[model samples]
Target chain A: MSDTTPAVEAGRLDTEALEQVLAAPAARFRHDYLEVRGLRVEFDGFVAVDGVDLTVTQGDLRFLIGPNGAGKTTVVDALTGLVAAAGSAQFGGVDLLGRPSHRIARSGVGRTFQTASVFDELTVLQNLDIAAGARRGPLTLLRRRRSVPPEVEAALETVGLAHVRDLPAGVLAHGQKQWLEIGMLLVQDARLLLLDEPVAGMSQAEREETGLLLQRIGEQRTVVVVEHDMEFLRAFASSVTVLHQGKVLAEGTVAQVQADPRVVEVYLGTGAHGRGSRTAATSTEVE
Target chain B: MSAARPGSARTAVARPDWWRREGVRLWGGIALAVVLLVGVAPAVLSDFRLNLLAKFLCLAMVAVGIGLAWGRGGMLVLGQGVFFGLGGYLMAMHMKLSDAGPGGVPDFMLLYGDGVVPGWWEPLRSPVVTVLAILLLPAGLAAVLGLAVFRRRVRGAYFAILSQALAAAFAILLVGQQKVTGGTNGLNGFRSFFGYDLADPVNKRMLYYIAAGVLVVMVVVVRLLMRSRYGELLVAVRDQENRVRFLGYDPAVVKVVAYAVAAAFAAVGGALFAPVAGIISPADVGVVPSIALLVGVAIGGRATLLGPVLGSIAVSWAETSLSEQFPSFWTYFQGALFIGVVAFLPNGLASLGGALRRRRARGSAVPEVGPASDVRPAAGSAGGVPADPPAGAPDVTTDTVDTAGRHA
Candidate 1:
């Protein structure tokens, strides 16, 4: 009976400790807001996302950097509920397993896809209006009854797109469209935002602006950003998680992760010729 | 959800609110036109023309359904003919049975060598049963079909194909069931509707007025539905289905409701069509005729409120007049017209007025506002940012670079 009592006490103590850990603010160096345990995604026996564990804590702008077939997007898909996932994904004590993407969205997680999904025909204001979830009924008969709240305008302003609000979303610049998408995420009031390659093809200036925008957005919310650009990661992300062959090879500050032998072996090994040139260019730019 | 931030305030823009001010004016104009045409035509036109107009009104009822389901909901419902056929067949059967006298088979059935009416047709002999069936049957079928298809998440081209196939199958089934359904000939040759003598000119005119009144009521009902929350959800589902789902709306259920309403409207139209047209045949309930109905809607601009009704009437009128004048080449001419409209005017004839108005306004030297370039600097940045590349530029390569940079 004494032995059983200690075991029960130990179980209770462990649960209390777990709860405390979940509730406690994440370390400044680690921004993991959500943690996945043994996530296994299969497509007819082809294991696209094999038993993988990932942690995305708050305040940590961690990069899920990997090669082409490394399942970074699949991990994002699983987290967003776009793809069915196996095992538990614990976020703020809620188990995000077997829930629909919309339910997941309502549960304080917002996501942007690799491709833009804005309505092409609708105006920029209309796009934002639709995303705002203000219009309640089918037709716009009562739409005029309730005016567009100031908050919606602020979101568009935040994205630096106030001037062309009346223009169709289709006419906006590519960078502006991405920003508009981010604005949509902002309107959703999600605690966590998942960005999939937000800066894939912008100019250096655009990329810098994006980096600044991400850093600003990250101050108020947890942002999980995936990218292939090491320079951008170094500039924006506080921490980095290197993925190779569907598993985390290393996770630390940009310099620390860059120095890790395994990360170098996997990321830099195949591109031996361009490594020195790129490194020199990066060092010169920093200086 | 985070606390509401004050930074999210939007600047109000001053634009001519067309959907509000101009929309009312346009609707008012339409109302005036209806008053002048429908209200005054009865006083001026012959009874025969008035009755023909009433039949057209019945067809307009079917158009209302097409507009709601296909235009707004984006459901390409080619099986509306099935509902229309159900209503017409039910009404025709009732009228035929009423004219046959108690315990007697209909005149056509007796002449066609049917000694006894089929058991399936027996229930329709009662006006109550027939009327109930007319309304309930089409809606019931639509509900069942909608449930099956929508539950499976079948949409787009697959949904269109499935609905068109249903129309074809319905027509074939009716044609095959000669003894029970009157086969390819269909139920027709009614002598009376609800104890009114069909031979009397006054009665025919009365039927026309009834159809016109019913059409007006249907339009009002559809307008109400379009203005309701359900209508907003329907359009939302059409535009951003995933987003609507995320907003906690089951788009399937919304689509089904819209589809069922459309089926009910079609059924009512079919019921009136039987009495007014004096015939309901396989030709009216088949795939070709179903496509013809859709053509009218597409020609008029399916999404526009009055497009379907006006388009259907116009097309029907053209077919009647052209066939009277040039029967052999009228079908070819109609096909050419449809092709030209689809190819050249994708938005349809309803948009023509808007386009013409815009052109005329432009011709009168109305200065158009160049694109606005007064974007405020991004929050936390005092420096004005340069204009970025347009989002939906044809150049995919540029987008790839922008996306890469933004994510990086």
Candidate 2:
């Protein structure tokens, strides 16, 4: 956008970077994982996603930024195997398209819900214990006790939730619930963490802590955060993909995208809160 | 215990220590249950009534299972009677065969016009085979059913309807198979239990002890399950299934195992019920009876460890007394009791004492103040931690806020 690239001027995709990245993504990446190609999701006769391709290198925190109804969550839902999707979604070298949600999660691709979804009745320790896959079998129920994994302990300590480890999760506030969910994904040893609006309901200070938390998590796992918070994305997202109407509207640095005349006029209206996802699911009509 | 924070903090503070208080309470409850079961029942009840209580104890075994499945796992298993009936019939067939001696058909088969024993019944003529069938047959059925339903992700009311339909179908099938199962009248009038003559009052008392022991074991097993990590996972599945799945747990496997255990318990109950009740019929293993098992649990508190057992016995006792007093209308009275309990005591009778205690303690608990911050950001540290206080913050009021707060 800043360079006056002809493809942006012409109102069509400049597929050079997307194609190059998808084709030989392994050569350019540290972790070099998560290649999605021509992924399409449909419901009834409507196409929610129409021929979208993405390649995420491991350990890079890529922010998937888009307006409301841009099929950002649908993308995560597809990768998480909650929807009937066509085309390839691969984690490392393994296909993720047809696997169940639990299998995909167990296979190192962890996802949090649009709303904070933690087990409300379970204690913080119990919640993390399940994510760590500790003593889960029926016969294993006979075992007197299992020691807490060191990693789980570290996660609770890191999230600042070690004190409330014994209290039921339902007692936690909104921000704490979000942090707890992320902690759950961390304990799952998720290689790729897909977080949807990780800071949606948090206050300014909590958002900062969460942003710092996400940045720290990004250092370890490949995190693809689907958020409408452009300011938060601008603060931490090193590379960004701008989605509009179920396609990659733009892809580059936040400054580059903000500078693009087409992007300024066509998307990112009224800053971050304009393109919200509260009505994102039903209001969007498929092409 | 605060209306602001609904955990067991205020009570914990009042006690000597958290674990000791909880440990004492748990052990006290267990000791009291054992005393009442072992000491008081035999001394108080007549032989006829004690036998009835033993039958109810077997019913309570199934209720204990229902507490785990329907209560903890959020699986509404209305077809437990399928397993219960199968075990009862298997045990009955074995006992009848044992009574008939070597290489002989049961008197019912001969007198009821089927002069030869069926091939299926022949294998069950062996007591060992019968015991194994009682243990494994119901489990196998439940495993298959649980796998099919849960793997397909069928849950909630659909699951309830499916289980009830199976129970109905099983009862119909049993009713149609008159020669083998003894049809509507059911298999009864057993002469012996493991060669102990049924006529002997001492052996009858032994049967009561057996029922009592088995129920105690089932309660303890269920208590262990509820306290275990897997038990917590089952409750988690019941609450937020998709969340559990995303946490890399197969909610289906968790559900299936709980269902199978529930089935096994019900089957065990049925096996014991045959020896104690001296009968098993379509009337006792149909949709009505299956739902009847749930009534006590619902009244008692399905989620609590002792609630289901205590509630089952209490309901059975009430039914006995009320029926003697008003034979025709006792069922309606029982129905009213169930409705009232469900409406008023949703958490059941087990929580009643806790609720009363909390109400009384509400006024006295303004005594303490600890700062609302733990090094763990205390919600206040983060400056945006929203509504409840941070984890270690002491709650002063022992107000009545439900532990299971409603979620969307």
Candidate 3:
């Protein structure tokens, strides 16, 4: 390895290769809706998101991929203002680094947790209506005012949950709940959507559907998804940023990054990049 | 793949047709019952009995606030008694000042220490000032306290402890301020309200009606709140504060608003309670009494629309009647009742109706399979299902674990 290309040359090889990678149907490159600079997040003594610099443009479908404990979620948490960060995270023109989660949300950065955050006791429509910010006016002063907005129905329709709109979110299947969470994000109409492992436990068919859903959503807003499932990532991600030890290991098109030797050693290790894995390496090469 | 999954037996029930169902019919019947009772009770019951009911109504008013804050907002508001006491003390001070006439000191002030009323108590001498103070003081205190605690992100057991400490501190302060607060005895021995002689039977009945009217108004107001967007937000804040924050709303502000509204209602109840109960003692504003108020709401079904009111009234009635019959055992009996209710009926008595209906539906729909027998596995495996578990169930961790496990 030492007899090989220089550090900068090796880095540029992956970057150049990544640029030539083909875009997936679900994942399209966003031109820079969010710009994060020198981001640093520390937990007591441990650095979580260390000096990470990334940008997510409008309509960008970015993937934050790494192995477990790679601090990928920490970066997402910092972007959403859930965790305190010591660097600049600007969305549009707003600095979200020190702002509260609510302020960040108001500034058009919406997020979904690894687990569904829907109100279990509430009806599915109510969940969407609540997410859509319905019942938030002077009419809420009066008792018996409507809880659901007209947009709630539209959101449910988009998520293919209109038929079960009245059922409680708690009763929905695992995949349906994930869809409902996405519908909530959609209803919010956030400029930047942060999805944490959207297809973590879904069936193959469900994951495929979610990929299609993400593809549709990516047309309207920037979506940054943190996922470990390489198949789903390959099927959805246009631009993948491989994170390892709180630093960006590789950033470019999936194919270019997959061919990067550094990414293979750190991220696309034996488990993720087995020999003869067609979807893992070959698809990226074809792109 | 075509075979029905054995574990997928519990499907989410279709949304209830609230308008066309018996639920609406049952609600209608309850409304009718309330109307009939209100209409005929005044004429049929003795004045003494009516007065008691009025007092119960006032207590119910306080419970309404408790229901909204603690029950729905997930704020364990242990200092509602502070608001209640504030209202009662204000009203009592005013009535006392009036009875003293001109510049004369209230009788308690002369007997205890200084022959002059305190400057703080001076404003409350006027009926207008007293009523306003009664309404504003509790709400103001609650708002300040709520802002401080909620803004700091203090919730669950910490919030409960903070509120309870406030109540304890308030009661002790009042007790220690003998010169101004009338010490442990508290302000009492009122002769009249407005110009109406409180001693007169008709006036007493009128007070009862007023209290009843106020209780009804408070209930309606809370009902409206619970149904409104704010109500939904309040519940959402209770269920998932962080999620609510991520939805473009400040959870602290929302919680504080609900807490303050609840405090205001409790103040109104306390003000009326002073006149009807004929006393405003430190005992009424202390920690133990505050817990007692929560007991009623919890037993009644804290989250339900009418649970707090019904539960409060029922508890108060039982306390009065039981204490009168067996004063020695009443406290112990009440404790037992709370323990039993909390243990067996975790959702409160209000949920019994819903539970019974569910049972009946299950019984009719699945005659061959017993619902009771299936409950264990259904509960065990229903990780993704969104059933409203009983209030006391330790389901918070379960939900978190299931969610994490699904994704992991």
Best by DockQ: 2
Encode model 1's per-residue lDDT on B1-408: one tens digit a residue: 012211211110243323235566557645865685568878987987777777777878888899999888989887788888888888988888888877778876776646688778789778888878888888888888898898677999999889889899989998887776778888888899989999899888888778877777777677767655456557767877766554434567778888988898889999999989899988888888888888888888788777888888888888887888888877898798889888877767887766554444343222223332321222112223345443212122222332332232
- Fraction of native contacts under 8 Å reproduced by each candidate: 0.17, 0.70, 0.67
Candidate 2, pairs of clashing residues:
none
On a 0 to 100 scale, what is the lDDT of residue B199 in model 1? 84
lDDT (Cα, tens digit) per residue for candidate 2, span B1-408: 134233445454555433335677677767877798879999999999899999999999999999999899999888888888988888888888888888877787877756888888899877788888888889888998899899999998999999999999999998898888888988888888889998899999999999898888888888888888778889999999988887777889889888998999999999999989888899889998898888989999998988888898888888888888888887898799898988887878887876665544443333233333332344344445545454433332222223322110
lDDT at position B374, candidate 2: 31
What's the C-alpha lDDT at position A97 in model 2? 96
lDDT of 3 by residue, A161-231 (tens): 77777666777776778888887886776778899988877777778878877866666578899887777
lDDT of each: 0.71, 0.78, 0.76
The estimated TM-scores of all candidates read 0.76, 0.85, 0.84
Best by TM-score: 2
Model 1 lDDT tens row, A34-152? 88888888889888777778776676676777776678888888887778889779776667778876667767777776776665556666666656563345445323325554555
lDDT of 1: 0.71
Segments in model 1 whose C-alpha atoms lie over 4 Å from true places: A1-33, A44-46, A85-99, A132-145, A149-154, A160-166, A200-221, A268-287, B1-20, B97-137, B217-233, B243-248, B354-408
Which residue pairs in candidate 3 collide?
A30-A60, A31-A57, A32-A57, A33-A56, A33-A57, A143-B224, A170-B385, A170-B386, A171-B386
| C-alpha positional error of residue B104 in candidate 3 after TM-score superposition, expressed in Å | 2.6
**Cα shift from native, residue B163, model 2 (Å):** 0.3
